[model samples]
Target: MPCDFLPAQRALLDATEHLIYTGGIHATGVDAIVRKSGIARKTLYRHYPTKEALVEAALRRRDDRWMAWFIAATSGYTDPRARLLSCFDALREWFASDGFHGCAFLNAAGEIGPATHPIRAVSRLHKRRLFEYVCTLTRETGLAQPDEIAEEFLVLIDGAISLALVFGDTHGADAAARSAQRLLRHIPVSS
Candidate 1:
């Protein structure tokens, strides 16, 4: 039997992720990915069965890549404050990248309207983890009200993303990072 896992299959998924994230899920059709990946239509269908499944796989891959980056970002800083700043640093880097298209989770969430949508679930989980990570960092910083700080931080990040997308500038992300750095610096180091 042929190997269940194939490099071509991975290439298709990777290509789908790039197209979907850079563009929008709805905007980039299955044919677009198949063409971009140079994979036969049959091969893609054989692996994914449907476009939605392929989209979900692409979304999952993006999430995994992002989570890996998050983990690595926190690893270099021992101080929770520095670690928290790293969050904004990462966001800034992401926003500043050449193909910078806003957040993948945000885009996918916009595409998949229903709460029950697989893409929605993936997007929700990604945002939840970011929020929870901030909360954990806030708690670690021993802030008097970590929960409140985490909430405020999340708002800042989300707002920054929106403004960035609206204005087609990375300034919003820069401002958010500055604000996060200023705000997080004040949290007491305890927990």
Candidate 2:
């Protein structure tokens, strides 16, 4: 609810994010988070109450930071079509980045499979926001049925990311981009 986190809270969150990304949700315990953050257990409990709560906060923070990065990366293209395609380029860059470990949301979902888990809820929220962003880009293209096209585009995007992660192939993004181009060609542009 509150974006304004205290110094200790921020530290704990940062530690959690790094640890979870490096190890995993189940592998990274609260004790590790506290030790890495240099925050006492009492302080962590004061802020988060439970490990699940801290995990949710970390995922939320990551969602915010990742979306900001993605939007900024795609902003360079003036044309809506080009901007839409640029998302794949961004993914390629991400895949090639050091310490790249695939989509955090997907990873979190896999690690915490229960549908009712708070972390899974956060992952779902992140995905919904991604779909919404695609819809925004599609609207800018002045295409017929932007919402439907955006949904299809999101499927391609997610599929590409999953393929890249599984096969360790950056070219998957390019393949996805080509498919996106084909999909875009089918949608009639507004006059």
Residue 25's lDDT within candidate 2 is: 94
Taking all chains together, the TM-score of candidate 2 against the true structure is 0.94
Runs of candidate 1 with Cα error greater than 4 angstroms are: 1-5, 181-191
Off by over 4 Å in 2: 1-3
Alpha-carbon shift of residue 160 in model 2 (angstroms): 1.7
Candidate 1 per-residue lDDT over residues 73-138, each given as its tens digit? 665789877887677677666677687777889988888879998889988888888888788887
Would you list the C-alpha lDDT of every candidate in the order shown?
0.81, 0.92
TM-score of each: 0.86, 0.94
Tens digits of per-residue lDDT, candidate 2, 1-191, equal 35789999999999999999989999999899999999999999999999999999999999999999999998999989999899999999998888888889999999997899899999999999999999999999999999999899888888988898888879889999999999888889877
